[model samples]
Target: MASTITTDLKNLSISEPVVIIGSGLAGLASANQLVNKYKIPIVILEKESSLGGNSIKASSGINGAHTTTQSNLNVNDTPELFFNDTTKSAKGKGVETLMDKLAKDSHLAVEWLQSEFDLKLDLLAQLGGHSVPRTHRSSGKLPPGFEIVSALSKNLKNLAESNPELVKINLDSKVTDIKVEDKKVTGVEFINTQNDKVETLNTSNVIFCSGGFGFSKEMLQEYAPDLVNLPTTNGKQTTGDGQKILSKLGADLIDMDQIQVHPTGFVDPQDPESHWKFLAAEALRGLGGILLSPSTGKRFVNELDTRDVVTEAIQIQCSKANNKALLVLGEGIYEDLKNNLDFYMFKKLIKKITLKQVVEDYKLPITSDELAEHLNQYSTAAKDTFNRPLVVKNLGDEITSETNVFIGEVTPVVHFTMGGAKINTKSQVINKDGQILAQGLYAAGEVSGGVHGANRLGGSSLLECVVFGRTAADSIANVN
Candidate 1:
C-alpha cells in the first residue's frame, strides 16, 4: 500500500501519514519496514534533490557481529565481545542499554539487508576498534554505502510506482518545525525549496533521521569550538536540521561536544587548503597500509588503532612535519584496494611508485636503509596476527628499493559529530529529564546519539542507522 501525496499543500495538511524526514539509510530503512511489514503509508521529506543523504558518502562497510557471513569466514566473535569493544572505544560514556541493543541486533541488521533487500554484503574486514573482522561489504568496486543506498532507493521507488498511494517522497523539502499538541507530535512544517514556499503536513508519526551537523560551521563553533576550522567530509545538508528542530521541542541533546576526527583525509596536492576533503577509508589500513611521517619516514602509530588515537598521532606527527604525513600501501594492499586507489590516483591524491621513487620524488628525510629497517620491523610484527589488541600484521612483502607502493598525503579532518538528540532503547526521542518528549516522534541514525559515547568505531555508524531505523519504525508500527 504505497501512495503519493498531492502537491497541494492543503491536501497534505489534512492527510495523516507516517512522515519520515531525511532520505538517508535511516529514513529509507524505516520506510522499508513500515511499508513492507506494517502496510503503512509514508511521506519522506528530503532537503536535497537526490534521495541518498551523507549515507552515499560512507566509504567503509557496516559492522555486524556473529553473522552467518562471519561464521562462514571462521571469525570468532559474539555480541558480548562486540559490546565490550564498543564500550571500550566509547571510553565509558556509552549508554549501556543502547550499546547492548546495537551489538545484539547487528547480525540481524546485516542479514536483513541481504535477505530482504537483496544486497550483497558477503565480504568482511576488520576495521579500527574491532576485535575481529565483522564489517561486511560486497567484493566489488562500489563502496558499501553507495551500493546499499542505491538498492534501497530503487526498491522504494519501484514499490511507490506499484502502489502510488502508499509512499510519497518529496525531495527539496526541508522540515523546519515539529508541531506538538497535548504533549504529542501532531505534524511538521517544512519549506519546499523549489518554490521557497512553506507547507504543513499532518502526520501521526515522525521519524527524524536528518543526520549529524558536521558541516554546519555555526553548530561546530557553538558545540565543538575547537573543531570550527577543521576540514570535514560530510555533505552540505548535514547541518543538524533534525537536532535543531527537536531541541526547540525540548528534546535533550547528549554528548554534543563529542566529535570524531578521522586520521586519513587525503590532502590533495592540487588543493591542499580545501576545506572539503576526500576520506581515505580505514579499510586501506585494515588491509595492511601504514601511516608514515613524511619527514622521518617512520611509523608512529599502529595502523589499525581507533580513529581518535590515529588522528592524534597524525596531528602530532604532522605538527612536526609541516602538517604532512604519508599513507603507504604495499602491493598486497594496493591490489585489495585497487578501486579506491584508482580513484585517489586519478585525483592525484596518491601516487604509485617504487620505494626508491618515493624516497627521491618526495625527498623523504630518511635514507632507503632507514625506511627498509622500519618495514622489516612491521612485517615481522604482523605475522599470525588475528584478533584483539588489534595489531598491524600482514604488511605484505618487506620494503626494498625495487618494491612498489601507493602513497598519499593525509591529515586529520573533522569527520563525525558523535552527539545529537538523545533516544531511548525503543528509539523514542527523549527530553533532558530522561522522558520521552512526544509519543509520535522518534529518532535514529546520526541524528540521535548516546549509542556512541565519546568516539565512534569505524564501521558502527552504518550499523546504528539500520538497527535503530528499523526499531523506530517497528515501534511506531505496533503503536495501534
Candidate 2:
C-alpha cells in the first residue's frame, strides 16, 4: 500500500496491456478482479492527474440487497424486492435484464468490497427510491466514496510494486481512440496531459469505464439541450470521452435524453450562481431531513421519495423569491449525521443561522408562528398532499424561535445521465441498431446505460461500477 505507480509510456507499447479507460470505481473494480483472478496484464489510463474520479465525491452509500449488514440491522430484504423497487422507479425506462442483474448481484458486490479491501460497509441508510434500508457505508468519519476508492487505489498501487509486470497505472493519460481491427477492439490511442505526447497501447481487449456527460456543456447541448443551464455535481473529466469513442464506431446508445437532475445541490450564499456546486447528499434526507417551500411554511414534498419526484416538486412549489428549496433537520438527525455535516459545514454548504435569517437571508416569507404551525401540523398529519410519512425521526418536532436546527439552500442540478452506450447483462457493448459490438470490447459504469431507466436510485451508481465492471472483467477472461 505504500508504493506508487506511474508507468513509463514506452513500456506499455511492448506489453500489449489490456487498456481500461478511466480510473474511477469501475476501472479499479475491473482491474482488481482481472489481476486477482487471472493475473492479466493491465493498464489503467486516467485523464486526471489523480486516481479517484467523481466517484470519490459520492456521499450517499452504495446499494445492496440482503447483505449481512441488512441482516444485522434485522431488516428483511431480498433481491426480488430490490428488483421490483428498481423496476418501479425506472417506470419502464430501465432494461429489464440489466435491472434484474443489478438487483441480484448487489449483495455480492457489497460483500466483495468488504472482503477484498477489509473495508466495512456496515452502516445502512434508506435513500430515495428505496423500499427498505439497504444502502451501506462505513461507520467511520470519512465518507463512503473516499473510503472505498482509497482502499482500491491503495491496493492497486501496492500491486504495481509487487507485480510490476502484471499491472501498470498511467495518470494524466486520456484515451482518444479505440483502434479496431476486423471489427474487434485491438488497442487505444491516448494523449499524455502532462506532456503533449500522443501514445497508443497494443491490446486486443479494451474496457470503457469513462464516466458521463454531466459536466459537459457541449455534450449537454447536443444531447440534452434543455438541461444545459443547470448546475452539475460531476468532475470536469466527465465529458463523455468514452461515449464519443464508442458512438463513432456505431455502438448503440441507450436513453440518451434521460438525464437525472438531482434534487439537492447546495446553493452557496456567497456564490449561488456557480455552475459547479456541492451536492447536499441524499443521505441527509434519508436520515430524517425535510424540504420546505418559501411561499408556504409547510413541507412541500415527501422528502424521502424518489429524486425526480422531489426535484419536480421543488421546481413547481418553491417560491420565486429564490430558485431554491429549504432543507431543515432536527437534533436526532444531526446526531446520526455529525460526520457528514462537519464536511458540509466546513465547505460552507450548511451552517447554523438565526431563525430571523430564514426570512432575511433565505427569503422565506413566513413568521415564527407560521413556521411553528407548519411543524406541528406536519408532526400530526395522517394524510398529506404528497403522502410522506407523518412521523419522521427528529423532524417536525416542537419548534421555538430559539430551537437549534440545521438548514441549507438546495436546488436541482444535472446530477446523472441515465443514457450512454448500450451494454447487455454480460457487459458487452451493443450497437444502437440492436447488434452486439466486437468481441474484445466492453463498457461499464456511468458510461454504459440501461442499468437505470428514467431515474437512477440513490446509492446504485457505485453498486453499478462493481457489478458490471467485474462482469466485464469476467467476460474478458472468458474471451481470452
Candidate 3:
C-alpha cells in the first residue's frame, strides 16, 4: 500500500502538482518523466485500492524497433518496417502521425524502462502482425507487466520518501469530475473510497492515464453493445472513468465501436461459467503453440495471425459446438513459456497430458496416427496451407503418440477497446471540430485513442503506454 498521499485539502489551494488520474503504466511513466526529467511535482489519483491497474496482469512483452536487444540478437528490424506493419494491421483507422511516432520512439521507450529500473529485457519473441522479433521481456522469471509495475512503484515510493512533495500516490481515490473555469480545465474532484469525503485538487494541467472500458458493464452496453456478453482480461477498475469524465468537456471520442476480441481466454474446468477468465498470453502462440479443432483433432488456422483473424476463425470453425478450441503446446513451447505456465496450471486453466489422452478425452473423429501425421507435416513442409512460415524447431519436429504436451480450452473474449477520447501525437485532447479542447488537459494510454486503429498487435500496448505517457509529460513541460 503506497498510499503515502496526505488527506490535507489545505494544500490544494497553494499546491500546483500536476494531477494524474490512475496508477497504471501510463500514469506511473508520465509521473516519472515529470519528476525526474522536468523536476515537477505530481499527485497520482488511483480509483482502485492498489497500484498498477490492468497493466499488472499483462503477460505479453513490450514492443521496440531497432533496439539494443534486437541488434544483439541479430534481428534485422527498423522503425519504418515496424511502422508499416502497424499500418497494415490498423486497417486505415490508425492515425498516421501517432502510429509513426509510436514506432519511431518505441526503442527509446524500451531503453528508458531498462535504464530507469536496471532491467535486462533480454528475452525476445515474434508475435502476430510483426515482421521480426522485437517484443522484449525478462528471462522467464515473472510476467513482464508485474516486473515493470513493481519496479516503477518501488521507485516512486522511494522518491516520495525522499521528498513527499515530489511524488505522491493516493490509492483508493476515485475521481468523479473535472473542475473547469474560463473554458479551460482547472482541477479535479475526487472522493477517497476509504473515507467517502470528497476533495478537490486544483492544478494547471490534468493527465488521464486511466485504462479502457473492457470490464465496465454499462460502458460496454453503451459503446460496444455486441461485446457486452464477452468476458474480459481487464481489471474491474478499468471502467472508462477518464473518458466519461473528460467527454463532458467537449472532448471528441473516436472509434467507439472498435473493440478487440482476443482469440484465447482459458476456460477453467472448475469454473467454466465464470464471467472472468485468465488470458492465454499471445506469447504462447508466438512460441509455436497450435490451435486445433476439438472435434476433428486437426489444425484449422494459422496460430500467428493477428488476433482478430484468429478469433474470427475460431468462431467460424467452432460455431457448431461450444465455440471452443483446443490450444496445444509442445514440450518445447511449455518450457519457453515457463514464466506463465505455473500459474496457468495451478489455476487448472491448462493441463499437462499425453497426446493419447488428448485424442481420447476430446472425442475426436481421427485416430492418434492421423493426428501425428498431420502434426509431422511441420517438420518437412516449407509452409502450411495457412502460410504459417518458419516452423518452430522443437515443436512438431517429431510427433509421437506418447508425446507429452500442455493443453487448454480457449474462447474469444473482449480484451482491448481501441476507442476513447481522440488525441494527437503531442498527447493533447482534441474536440470534435479538430481543435484543442482545453489549455491544460491531456490523455494517454488506452484512455486516449488513434494509435491503434481497428486491431492492436501483441506487445504494442505496453509500448503505447511508455511512449505516449512520456510524451504527455513532455508536452506539459513545454507548456508549463
TM-scores for the candidates: 0.94, 0.94, 0.96
Please give, for residues 1-480, the per-residue lDDT of candidate 2 as tens digits.
122233343354334567889888999999999988777778899999899888899999899999999999899999999999998888899699999999999999999999988988988999887889898999888898888999999988998899777788999988878888887876788888777777877778889999998999998998889899989999899899899889998888888889999999999988988999899999988887888887776677888889899998999987473558888877677767888888888888887764556656765678766676567666666755667665344753566565556888899999999999999998999986777788688999999989999999999999999999999999988877
- Candidate 3 TM-score versus the reference: 0.96
Candidate 1: C-alpha lDDT:
0.85
> By lDDT, who's the top model here?
3
RMSD of 3: 2.9
lDDT of 3 by residue, 111-161 (tens): 999898887888899998899999999885889999988888888899989
Rank all candidate structures by their TM-score, best first, as comma-separated numbers: 3, 1, 2
Superposed by TM-score, candidate 2 places the C-alpha of residue 43 at a distance from the truth, in angstroms, of: 0.3
User: How many pairs collide in each candidate, listed in order?
Assistant: 10, 2, 0
Model 2 clash pairs are 252-431, 252-432
- Stretches of candidate 2 exceeding 4 Å from the true structure: 1-16, 354-360, 380-385
CA lDDT of every candidate: 0.85, 0.85, 0.87
> 162 in model 3: Cα distance from truth in Å?
2.4
**For residue 450, what is the lDDT in candidate 1?**
92
